[model samples]
Target: MTIKPLVIALGLITGSVVLSACNSTNDNKTPITDTQNLAAQHSDAKPVVYQVFTRLFGNTNSNNIPWGTKEQNGVGKFADFTPKALSEIKAMGVSHVWYTGVLHHALVGDYTEYGIVLDDPDVVKGRAGSPYAVKDYYNVNPDLAVNPANRLAEFEALIARTHEAGMKVVIDIVPNHVARNYQSLSAPQGISDFGANDDTSVTYARDNNFYYVTGEDFSVPSSQDYQVLGGEPHPLADGQFTESPAKWTGNGARAAQPHIHDWYETVKVNYGVKPDGSYDFATLPAQYAQLDYRAHYAFWQDKKLPDSWYKFRDITYYWLDKGVDGFRYDMAEMVPVEFWSFLNASIKMKNPDAFLLAEVYNPTLYRAYIEQGKMDYLYDKVGLYDSLKALMQGKGTAQQVLDVHASVKDIAPHMLHFLENHDEQRIASPEFAGDANKGKPAMVVSHLLSQSPTLLYFAQSVGEDGSEMAGFGKPSRTSIFDYIGVPAHQAWMNQGKFDGALLSEEQKALRAYYQKLMNMASFSAIAQGELVSTPVTTRSGQSATNVIGFGRQSESQRLVVISNFDADAPQTVSVTLPAGWQGNAIDRLEQHGQVALNNNQLTVTLAPLASAVFELEN
Candidate 1:
């Protein structure tokens, strides 16, 4: 199946495209056929991912104590994601559920009774710890299990439940690094721990799992503002997280004592890339660019690749065998692109339709990662997210949004659009737009403006403000490092009922709106259509500065979307349609009265920070 580029042209409109009325009584309405809706009918539905920080999602306890233990603050369990909870998520039009923090990571918790060593507070980020610092790649987090001995069974049950709810499962795979004390207790019979067989005396080796500093001992970073477990005393918080022959920091800091700001809790993985920025392994020829994952997989089958490559490949296959749908690779660009080519191809060979998403920020490396790395999607962060964020904050214009789309039009379909994720500030936070309602229009534009997968952070619909001062992570972004209850999400959770009975009227309305928007964006004609930038002008023929317009046309439907970014003022704008389009514009959103087209243009009146989706029909 050939995926076409989502076209975003400037001032160029195509020939007349006709669309039947959504509620037409006429017998001559055009019927959607399998050929016309092939993308939706033949392939997987355009994915709408709901990323839940698993440790925090089902925690009904609201005792958000700072640096508190799980006994004090409470941790969410895998059993908490009941059938009802998953049903509610599926009803929100989520095709995929990314369960974050499922793996066993280094944390300041005592689980010695369960055969897990107590993680030193000096190396752990918070009481719960950072999920990125993975300690055991082969085991699930014991804290999330009702029975620690059956943690893997609990995770497998969650996967089965997610699939039963009609949603695919996605989990994080931090390929660039692992916990400073990396160990794999549940590895297969023949498999060994990451650095168990390595020669620590060397700085770099083709087969070494980690890079070493030879003679230097690892030292804990020094900081005055930050303290181990917020200055509270603990046995392992004695200013020492022991390591002989110091390894490189996760972010490539080679110092024995990395800076306080560095990713000190994690250590970088070695992929046969030497110190002077040179590949020690075989590089794929330029001709491989046009080849498929099968060819890439075959290319590496005979080559002597690095041992780390095979380790990650084995890890991915382990999860795939357990029915995991795909992975969300963290910091994919930090590792060599060749490694991705090797890893992702192996994934495709196992599951041809696997959904491979990566966190790659560099625009220059986007094509290399997607085309060569065989990635299905990459974060559209630096481009679309940044532009939309600026527009939402009133520091950017509608043109900036259009311009960014134009810049990445060639790879737009592979670029996933998101407004909120774990790493980003919540739209309702004071540091952001300061109101949940402000995200409404921006979301419409972000979701509908491209033919890409859409991501919604958990509780984004109900307006999670991320304002809790939960231990190491402060306000503005939800704490991935602490155990805390999300107030807005908990209100919607309503004590595991999965119903919004306790939510405010405004939050309920916002959630309803999100449901409608997500459904339309995911399963409607907009999901697999060509996006054309529609020219917008005021009634007086001047460009509407704050209003952006675009058209999504599939064989089955034609839609004109107009959004007003102005927070305090309504705007009356005219949207120019294609030359031969003659129809009555029925407002799909808000259901204002039918808009009449005059001289190949449809005039719209939008409220402050409002959006309209006008479905045109004869």
Candidate 2:
């Protein structure tokens, strides 16, 4: 499993859009036609991503001490995702299992005997540490293993288990930044740590792994009211974490002492991008936007890229060889799109069907990242997620969802939808809708609105409120930074049985609803169908602002979906069907009486925060 580092010297390489046809070199590649492309695009079931915060998923420890140690809180191991658990997750119609925080990260734990270096408390976020602050790229987190020495093997077994359960494995790859004390103890013999060969005298070098703040020693940021371990005493809590010639913070903060709000625990990786916002590497030609990943990979084959680019690419290959299916790139927009074009092209060359999902928030950059950067999917955070959140909080109307969907309709299939993730506030939280039921209609819209992947955070079904004041992570979001137990998720775990024996009736019903919706959403018609937004109006002909109507049509199926956002009142609305849509509407969700249609319009009544999927039968 050894990867030889790219030994290209520093040199400027210009890129051109190769408009010429792909060379017929016998590289064992098969030419794909237009029909094949379309068929390949929709060949599989809709990807239902189940994102589980790895360490917290199976942790049965009810002792959720704020900023508690792994010992006190009892951290879950990679072994906890047993066969039963994977089967249960697969039963939810999940196509992918995102094992978040699988990488070795800077954590407040002692593994000195295992030859792992101790991370200073000042730089570490919580007891378990922020998963994004990756300390090593070549190894799994020791805290996640039953035996620290066999951590990587344990993770490999987990990957196998996930695959055996008929689900793909997705892990995080924080390419934009890494831990402030980045040290890859498990790196292969030839691979060197980042900044090892760097000329730190200059602020920005073309090949330097990180941007150095020359002549300035790094200083720990002012914590203000926040204490390093909740004011608890520890040897490393002496307010001193050393780094000479400080590198820029992960958020691109150039200060020697970054603000407390800045991502001070991690340092940004330089991908041939200068501090003046100029690219140090060759920028992809605008014409290259129309090219495929293979062409993109061919273009960069001869070009000398930045060392950081090779490093991340090699890291990706390392995981791919480990049988890990795909990656969820963090803060992908922060990295240069050109770099993605090169790296993702290389990934595609190795594994064409690899699932590449990224966290890209800018609506303007969506097309570039997807079409040019070769990303399979990007987070629909700023667009659909924000609109849905506002609607749930009573601050917006259902029209906003339609508008947001319309804005990115061209690339809707590449936009991944989600109501909750590790970063977002839980729907059951006081700061959010404060009721799990409020997410029903939103989930319906998110899942069925487009031909895109849907991410379901762990315990989102049983309604985890995320109300615990878990150290650095405040209420409303599950604590990714600390060692804590998720009550709702634990109830479903049922002591490793992976059954919901301990769940309340409401919780049980919510889980069942999620399972049903997920399975239905996986259907070929709803998953890969073309969507047509239908008009919805009240009986009096006024726009039904609280209701949204849309139709998903395929060669084999035609379905109409309507959701009521209003949480207090039931609304009867007239949905104008697509032209030439003539059929009996059968309720797929509730199996209610047939919906009557008059003059191409169907009238339906929906309770507050309820949704219906009507299968149009000819």
TM-score of each: 0.93, 0.94
Give the per-residue lDDT digits (tens) of candidate 1, residues 448-493: 8776789999999999999998999679999999899999999999
Question: What ranges in model 1 sit over 4 Å off?
Answer: 1-44, 522-524
Q: Which pairs of residues have clashing backbones in candidate 2?
A: none
RMSD of each: 7.8, 6.4
Worst 10 residues of 2 by lDDT: 1-10
Which stretches in model 2 have alpha-carbon errors above 4 Å? Answer: 1-41
Give one digit per residue, the lDDT tens place, for model 2 in 1-618.
Answer: 001121211221233222122222111112211112323545767788999999998899989998888878878999999999998888888988999999999998889999998999899988789999999999999999999999999999999988999999999999988999888988878999999999999999989999888999999999568898898888998888899999988888888998777788989888887776778777788767777887898889889889999999999999999999899999887888888899888998898878889998767677777767888889999888999999989998888878877777656777799999999889999899999999999999999888778999999999999988778857899999999999999999998888899999999999999999988755667666777767899989999887888888878888889999999999999999878888689988764568867789989889888889988887
The residue-level lDDT of candidate 2 at 553 comes to: 81
Question: Alpha-carbon error at 598 in model 1, in Å?
Answer: 1.1
